[model samples]
Target chain A: MFGIRSDLPLRRDTASRFVVWLVMVLVFMASLAVTVNSYIGVLIDDWNRSVTGTLTVQIPIAAAGDKASAILVNKVLDVLARHPAVAKSEAVPRAKITALLGPWLGNSEAISDLPLPALIDVEMATEGTEAVTAVTASIKAAAPEAVIDDHRVWLNRVMSLAQGFGVVALTIMLLVTGALALTIVFATRASLAEFAQVIDILHVVGAKDGYIAAQFARRALVQGIIGGAAGLALYAPALALVAWLASRVDSEVLPDTALPAAHWLTLAALPLAAGLLAMLTAHITVRRALSAKV
Target chain B: MALGRKKAEEISGDAVGLEAVGLHYDDGPDVLKDVSLSIPQRSFHFLTGPSGAGKTSLLSLMYLAKRPTRGNLKLFGENVTQAKRGRLAAIRRHLGVVFQDFRLLDHMSAFENAALPLRIAGVGEAVVQRNVNELLNWVGLEDCKGAYPAQLSGGQKQRVAIARAVVNRPKLILADEPTGNVDDTIAMRLMQLFVELHKLGASVIIATHNESLVARFPFPRLHLDRGSVSILPPLASSAEFDHDDPRG
Candidate 1:
């Protein structure tokens, strides 16, 4: 115990600095995960509920004077409405199309300059992809000039991509935690080596191995706890910033759905767990090193 | 020569005894070979040899740091060849060792370092304070009791080491080159302290290269030549002066 107490100052001075840095890094990563994950959760939920039953119809004209295109869109809409599964349909006005294109084509530019296809937004009654596929096939057979898109393919792809990203973020967190553990192990080993002669002297004076090992363990525990707390402290604020930044994104592009609370809780638990793991790793490593000697 | 405990007596009691002991490190040359000697109860002897003559290695064996590759080593009358780790630790609690380098813990203050043996043995705080202070004062280091090892001079650190070694009044005390780093006056004083300990019934073995010390002290000399030990005659005649200090 005295051996451990004697190393308090040196342990605090060096270990605290390392712990602070580790906490900062962990907090940054945790906040980033929470922020990015919340956005992904929102996107997935929106796609599953709102976008899954929706489809779009576009009519492209081969000539400058083609009233047939508009006529064909109306026909497709009528056919879709008669089906029992079809809920509603609307012809997207040219103004809405121009507004959607305003980002790429400046608002000052005339819409007439470009030959834009006339589009009809369609809503179906069912959620499954099979219903949309069957309805699309019927619409295509009736009007060859019309193109039907149910968005299920792209939305599925987007969901898969988002999940993949979440996994990557989680993996990065694991790697960072592992690196921190390795760092703690190395530092503890250095400390043990530095005090090798001291340990020998103590043993000669009838200090048991348990007595010597306790000193190292105690020092590491204090370091681990303090470092872990510091890391968590940094993590909280960074996550708050992420939440703030997420809240400020233009709702027109990224909607203002409340962030997922579970993700934030997971972020909150990270530093504490990492700190404990580091402490345990340091203790075990030190004990093993000492035990291997006389 | 005042052989406090004979080899036969040590065998009958729970005390340390070596018989034809030899030690060699793994994948290294032999460090100790065929060294047979007995240190009886309340006896004082000085080990004399040149540098790298295994004085420290012999002392390490005395402290149970390593086992002999050949021959029997008995501590407290139990054969230590198959001694369990727990039993070894228990035996070590009654032993004290002083290193030439002092080996005081750099992290602890002088007082704490000196009190380590008692602390390891689970002595109470009050007892520790009393004994540690007296030992510190005996070594003339009472004023710097709170100072760290790094803050003290080489000589001061040596004194602290000596104080720590003898603080427990151990059954056995082994000092390897204890006076190597001190002045002559300090060295003699330290030797006198060893003499005082020997008089108090603690067996002591001092290993040094100082032939002058061997000449001055009328004690048995164990000479090491190329990893072997040979006992020499006592420097002082036994009956010259019964009036002179018997331990000295």
Candidate 2:
């Protein structure tokens, strides 16, 4: 802790320091909220971007024609397997498909009797090169009914939308953090001006602006860190509850997904970043205010 | 050179000097003009004048509150006209000021106010504690050390201000009407403290309208009238019939 300028030793009271700490904590929390939301947005965008290049081959047939359809799917898979960019290919077994649709279709007799497609989920190693054009040409000539659902056509647009949304969210968070920093700076400047007489007294007694500003900046930094931590603590449970709620919903049209570890890690980094940002802004503002006075 | 030798003597001198020093508030008429004088090292002096005689204005210049419009101001033998902020701060540490209003930080206690000068100097805690307690006891405000400025009486506040000013043992002490808000007995006692400080090697410059008090102390006088200073011939002990009346 920095020494306050004055010959008169002020009575050390913990109450005032605590109040300052509480205020900083609240500011820190606000910063944390912006950080977590921005990070989550970033994670979703990354996931969306990663999943775009792959395609699935679905062959639907009447119940009587299922055995023949399986043979045709095998022929199409053979052609796809020979492609240079095809990293790995696997056919999603009918039993696994039935289990995936279980919650939506339930265990009803009607759903059990309904015929389903024989689907082959394919993945390509091409990071930059489009493997779909060559693979489609090979598969179509081998099996007439084989449909290569090249996900790129729609995934490109979807991933781009996700990235655009993340950018907008990030922009909003940056703006909010900037506004909070400005508010703290303005408040500190006002406090400094109001105590001009005290400043003059301190100045004549050899108190440097750095000394005084450090006291103010340290207080503001602590307040921001505490605020961010407290807010994050509160937000953690709320976010968990929301994630829990999201997990309880039955999967039908929407895919059943779990948030990645990277998303959680990003969320955790928010509060600390918020605290540092608040401290930096407060430090700069207080130093400027003191310098202006001198 | 003559100038270098003079500068050396000035730096080692116990007091400061003002040469043709004039002050003006941004675009306003001059508040002080053509004031040239040297306060002898370790000497005590009283400034006397009627209302609005620029006593406070003159003091402000000495304390470095407002820069002068024209003239050479020498503090501790250093020419302050082109002094950097760092140099000015170094000189300021050797100076103390007591304002008329007591100008104590409202947020701090009386003890804190006194400890302020020490704290600014970055004195160690144990040393600060010892010095602060001694000064508080000296001012007769040990019991009220924890009390805030608003809670203290006028005389007590003035004593605290004096204690704070002298805490650093500054080379010069500037007091603006140190006894204005107190009674005669308290005022006289306060005057005694200034005398005590002067005896201990700190040159004292007090601005006041209390002529009777000024007469009681046989010090050189600086009289300010119409924005200029006139050094009256130093007063001798009064031979007049003054033994009967303490107020006189």
lDDT score, residue B100, model 1? 86
* Model 2 stretches astray by more than 4 angstroms: A1-54, A58-75, A81-120, A123-133, A140-147, A250-275, B1-14, B82-87, B181-189, B237-248
lDDT (tens digit, per residue) of candidate 1 on B1-248: 11234457554564457888888898688888877776666777888888889988888887888878889887656677667665677778778888888888777899998998888777898999998998888778878999999999888999998898888887788888889888888887888788888878788888988887776777898888889988887676655423344344
lDDT of 2 by residue, A70-113 (tens): 78778878877887878877888877888789999887667656
Candidate 2: C-alpha RMSD after superposition: 5.9
Q: Is the docking of candidate 1 incorrect, acceptable, medium or high quality?
A: acceptable
Tens-place lDDT per residue, model 2, B1-248, is 12244556655753777889887888988889888888877888888888898999888788887677899888767777667666667777778899888888777889888888887787887888899899788667889999999999988998889888888888789999998888887777677677777878888999988877777767779999988898875454545314413344
Model 1 lDDT per residue over A98-124, tens place: 999988888876765677888888788
Predictions: Cα RMSD each:
6.7, 5.9
lDDT of 2 at B64: 80
Note the B-chain TM-score for every model. Answer: 0.89, 0.89
- Among the numbered candidates, top lDDT falls to 1
Best by DockQ: 1
Measured on C-alpha atoms, candidate 1 has an lDDT of 0.75
